[model samples]
Target: MLPAPLSEPQIRTGTAAAAPAAAAKVAPDAAATAPAAKTSAAPAKAPPAKAPAAAPAAAATSAAAASDAQPGLRPTTRRQWALAGILVALAVIGLTTIVVGLARWIAGLEPIAAFIAQYPGTYELPEGAPIGLPAWLNWSHFFNLLLIALIIRSGLQVRGERKPPAYFTSKRTGQKVSITVWLHTSLDVLWIVNGLVFVVLLFATGQWMRIVPTSWEVFPHAISAGLQYATLNWPLEDGWVNYNSLQQLAYFVTVFIAAPLAIVTGARMSGWWPKGADRLNRAYPIEWARAVHFPTMLYFSAFIIVHVLLVFTTGALRNLNHMFAAKPDDDWLGFLFFAGAMLVVAAAMVAARPALLSPIASRFGTVSAR
Candidate 1:
């Protein structure tokens, strides 16, 4: 049945025919799979294209975070604050001028003149009152000025310091405080002692009578003197003999009322207060002391400003003599002493840096970086 094996050409033709049929069958399957493959590939390519769009949103978010991190007043807000300050200053100046003008006009009236003539701004002191400032009083004044200035500087430093440059640890008690606080407390102690001495001397020498008002007439006289001052026609310069009614009252308030209040409030806030005494602490809370202490400082500042301004304006030479030289004459000696005292104050202020203070502080206690 072999019929003589098939020729080569016929065999080739048969295989070729089978191959085409197989190819036709496979073409349909490939067509179907191509669509699905392309769909999957399309999504993958689309993600890369969309990636750039998200980048801008991410950048915007980062920028917003950065802005929030740095907090500060806006330029417009700062400008507004500057403008407000300027307006307030102008308003104050305008008000002061108006008041002075009005006071001047009122003081020119005949009735006011007669009233001024009656009071003359000062009443006679008690017969036993001291006539002039003593040498001890002048020395006390100088020391008081020096100590007060230093105390104020240290106090301000303590209030503003977030990171203290140095700390002071008590040698015996092992309590620690900022160097600024230590200096402030130390100056306060010295000032208190000096004040005590001044008070003792003032009473012992009968100098208190000059500052302490003894008559109801002082009120009207003080009002008259204030009016005179407002009008730029100040009361007579007679501090060497006796202060004006207003001056007397001011001194009395400063020495008696303000100083005691400052001391009490300061003590309440200071570390010197017994920490174990919860009952005392509850009775006079530290918060109350804090509230009062700042206002007391402000009062002292105002008093110093007004006192210095009046001393310079009313009669510089005579007042300087009365305060510094313990004399009534208007000579250059008092001015020289005042200048020297001021130089000392300036030197002390300049030398109050941590570098200089640390060594001195270490003498009494251990000084360390905070």
Candidate 2:
């Protein structure tokens, strides 16, 4: 009746109809008004529509810059780390040579032995302390070594990751995480499990007496043992029956103290930890976890190095026999067991690749390529 109501497309086309008229009105002053024309017409053409869109883009850029500005962990460069290792190795060799020379030349090696013998640093066993390495202990030792090696490998990979090689997304909640992190956390769980088993067996079998300190004399004994070690006049090799004070203390710290500290700190930094628990996060911040976890790893690394060296250099056959064969007698059987254990360890290393892990990761969550 009044004119059919314009369709949606017609209304849109009507806006263009007014443009020619508007342009005609400004045509006479086109030369002088050109600049003004552009300024006036730009809003109609694009500005209002584009301005709102630009705000979000600008905000996103600012957010990214702010995130980049935040403080992050800085890892030592590989070259620097390698150089430090070389220096440490040289220092160990140099110190050992000098100490041995002084022990031999100054007062003869016998005096050094006498000094070690005179020190009252030996741990006196109570009634019926467990003696000799048990089969459970031998197996547990190998398992612990394997788990620790894998944990460290994955931990270093997680620490140095600049960009993840793959990602894991939760099937239920669509949460995403890096694959390296998955491996690291998985290894942590395994290590903890193995440790718990070791602890239970240790107590059940009365082997706690071997590692746990029973007397204050352990301190002086540890010092004496340490000095004897430094002078290349080590205490008697009797690990099958008993450990020296230094060994006892080291095992005590590793089992009772350091391990627990590592577990707590590691859990705090992991995905298993509950998120947005303000009080808990405040009490145990990520910074604390980061600070403790890394140094603990270094301590384990150093301990392993020195422990292995002493095992080999002090009495390889006896040490190997005790750990691998669970026997006091020296023979090639222990070495054969060691070789088999190493092959298992090697197979584990080979299977830890991203390609292999990605499929396994998919069972827990949706795995994606980075």
TM-score of each: 0.81, 0.73
Candidate 2 residue runs with Cα over 4 Å from true position:
1-92, 98-115, 171-174
Query: Candidate 1: how many backbone clashes?
Result: 0
Candidate 1 has an lDDT of: 0.88
lDDT of 1 by residue, 160-230 (tens): 99998889997866789998898998899999999999999998999989888999989999999999999
**lDDT (Cα, tens digit) per residue for candidate 2, span 115-186:** 556763477866899989899999889989898999888899888889898998867556678988888888
Error of 1 at 161 (Å): 1.2
> Every model's Cα RMSD, please?
17.9, 12.4
lDDT of candidates 1 onward, in order? 0.88, 0.84
At residue 222, candidate 1 shows an lDDT of 98
